[model samples]
Target: MHEFTVTPYAVEGDVDYDRLLEQFGADELTDEQIADFPQPVHHLVRRGIFYAGRDVDRFTAAANCGDTVSIVTGIGPSGPMHLGHAYHFYHAKYLQEQTGAYVYIPLSDDEKRFSKELSFDEIHKHARENVRDLVAVGFDPDRTSIVVDTADADVVYPLAAEFATELTPATVEAVYGPPPNVGLGFYPAVQATHLLLPQLVHGPHPTLVPIAVDQDPHVRVCRDLAAKQRYDVEKPAALLSKFLPQLGGSGGKMSSSDDAPSILLTDDRETVREKVLRHAYSGGRSDVEEHREHGGDPSVDVAYQLLFYFFEADDTELERLAADYRSGDLLSGELKRHAADRIADFLEAHQRRRPDGPISEVVEPYRLTDGERDQLSPEVFDDV
Candidate 1:
């Protein structure tokens, strides 16, 4: 068996998603399960970008029956928001729209601090910016709650503390390797708190986490905690996806830390084009005559993959572009520019909706309400 790392803190080397299912004990989503998703499933699920999952049927069944269902996904505030981050959130928003599922978006500022060389102040700055981007995603303010781990410690910490008891140091080390400090050792508990948050606040109903495949370890750990029955919570089901390829044409997760440029949510049309044209790897041959003779390979082309993964929503149009590229009628540069234009259009609309007011005012409506906070941590509420 080839060894590759897949942990909450790190993902390296090429990933075999099928093997990941075997290692993680999750099932590949069947067509029937995909169809069960509220009518008109998002292309991500329909096209199998979200390939594997644990107990997806349970979540879909709940959604179909109009039972209380929730989607929990989080972001680490070590860097700016990128297209890869937006992919899952958009899907979450789609699910919320169709089924009225409660959406909990946790800004893991504390986790970022423990894992990265960032000051708390810097992490909070990123968190605030991330909140603005998330707000723009248009989740129903009434049904959505965004919690920053440090800012919402009154609820977050107490819940994490209780779950922390179940996690042994050995388990943490085995999954994440030795932590640099005590804080990192306990971060998994915080993550578990994130996954179980909906049930913890509203009582156990079906909860699902839509995340990239590398992050499945966090879901697994949290599921174990829920299975203990130490708290009145159900294990979070997962919808696992392949990494959106980096612009450098690598078969690995995209990252802010990578040398290849990432297209940030804040990038402008010109900047988007600059990055794609300059950095996007091409599968077309060097010479025009050779490219026309051999055509291009969409399988290894980063530009086409970007369009396939999220940008190009129209299936018929996407197929035309793919077919054209493979026939060498669409030049590599043309494909890159086409993807850049589509992405810039998306970001422009997203930026237009992003709150321009003070962060506190914009985030106020969606913060956990007093009563909900009390449900999670009455003891901490008294001190606050």
Candidate 2:
């Protein structure tokens, strides 16, 4: 067995995803389960960007039958949002559109504070920018709620406190590795609070958390807490995806902290092209003539994988591109240009729709309602 480590806080070395599923004990999504998703499924699901899951059947059943369903996918405000972050949120929006699933997005500034080198001011700034990008995704305000951990600590903290009692220090260290600070020791409880927030507000309902496969430990720990039956909540199901490989071809998760430039949400056409052409790993032969004879390998081509994973949604068209690449008809430069163009197009639309105004004003409508705050933390409210 090749040694690799995957924790919510870090993913190191090349991950064996099949082995990861076994280690995490999550079920691979079956064909039948895929069929259960509402019609016109997002390409992410169809193409296996999201490959494995836990209790997906129950969430699909709820969606199929018009029962209350919620999606909880969050971000730590450690940096600007990148294409990898957009991938998860965009899929959540697609499901919300199809099934009218309530969507809850949490901005874990607290976690960022504990985990990153940034100050609270810096973290909050990123959180605000992330909110703008999220609002631009166009989640239905009527059904969508966004919570910032510190901004909404009245509810978040109390709820996390309730779950913290159930978490042992050994278990936290085992899953997340050692905590850098006391805040991290309790942050898993905050994550548990995020997963179960939908149920806390609207009563028990099927909730799905779409996240990277490495983050499954967070879902598993939360599931264990829910299973204790202290809270009136059902365990949240998870949709796990392989990492969106970084541009450097390391096969690790795309991250803003990487040495190679990440395709940021703010990148313009020229910036996108520059990054893709300069940094994207090529799977072609050393010489152009050799590449023409043997063809490029799309399996290891960063550009092709980008298009296949999320940018190129058309099944037939994507397959045609793949065939052409494998047959030496598509050169590495041409494929990189194509992927950059597609990515730029997507970002253009997102930038156009991005919300403007004081972050406070823009976020108020999406924040938890006063009544919900009271419900989740009457003691805190009473103190106020």
Candidate 3:
């Protein structure tokens, strides 16, 4: 057995996802659950990129019944948004479109400051850029709300303080080690607030959080808080996902914080091509003659994984590519080029939709409405 560590802060070793489910106490997403998703299931869910969840049945039941459903998926704006970030966000958009689910996207600028060396200004700058990328995902503004920690502290802080009292420092230490500062000690509460915000504003409803498996601790903590029943809310369900393969082919999660080259959402065609051809790991034989004789392993090829993960959505086409690669009919360079082109195309579409205006204006449509603010924290607008 390969020894591995999975935490919200770090992931090390070759992760055995099934074992991770055991360790985290989350249920594997069964075929029944997947089928329960709105017809024409998303590639991410259908393909098993999102393979595990907690309390998923409840959310699915509400979604299938046309009851109110909500999705809480967030980004920590410590760096640029990458392809890894797009899969879940796009999946969230799909859920919203299919089920009329409300989507809540929170940018944890303060948490980034607590963990990373980046200053608040730098994190906020990234937060603005991240919001632009998220807006490009084309969520229904009426049903989607984007909240930033510092910018919305008027409501975020008050709610966090309420939940913070219930989240003990010892629990924080057990989940995530001792914080360097007091800010992080209280972040779990804020995260709980993020998970519970929909219920707080819209009243109790089934809320789902689609996140990487490592972030399950956040959901677990929030679930514990919800179990206390101090508030009228159900435990937020979680759909946990496997990490998108990094360019380095180290079998680790792709992250902007890592030194590995990430396919940033802003990269152009030429840049993407260069990065893939140079950095993408290959599973081909050392020489062309040997590769043609023994065939390449598409299962281990980073290029093929990219296509399998999200870039290539057609199952037939993906299977064809994989079979051809296994037969040595598709060369590694050719596969890399194909992945690059597909990725560049995705980024181009996203870039085209990316709003170009002042940050406030770009985010205004997605901000929590005055009525919502009053519901979550009426004191913030009491003077108004």
- After superposing candidate 1, which stretches have Cα over 4 Å from the reference? 1-3, 380-384
Which residue pairs come into collision in candidate 1? none
Give lDDT per model, in order.
Answer: 0.90, 0.91, 0.91
Displacement of the residue 239 alpha carbon in candidate 3, Å: 0.3
Off by over 4 Å in 2: 380-384
**Which whole-number lDDT from 0 to 100 does residue 261 have in model 1?**
87
Tell me the lDDT of model 2 at 276: 99
lDDT accuracy of residue 232 in candidate 3: 88
Residue-wise C-alpha lDDT for candidate 2, range 97-126, written one tens digit per residue: 999999999999998888878899999889
> Per-residue lDDT tens digits of candidate 1, residues 1-384?
666877778888777787878888899999999999888988999999999899999999999999999999989988899998999899999999999999999999998888889999899889989999999999999999999999999999988988898999988887778899999999999999899889877788999999998888889889888999557788899999999989998678888877888999999999999999999989888988888888899989999999999999999999998899889898898899999999999999999999998999999999999999767785734555
Q: Given candidate 3, what's the lDDT at residue 128?
A: 91
Model 1 / residue 148 / CA error / Å: 0.6
- TM values, all candidates: 0.97, 0.97, 0.97
What's the CA RMSD for each of the models?
Answer: 1.8, 1.6, 1.6
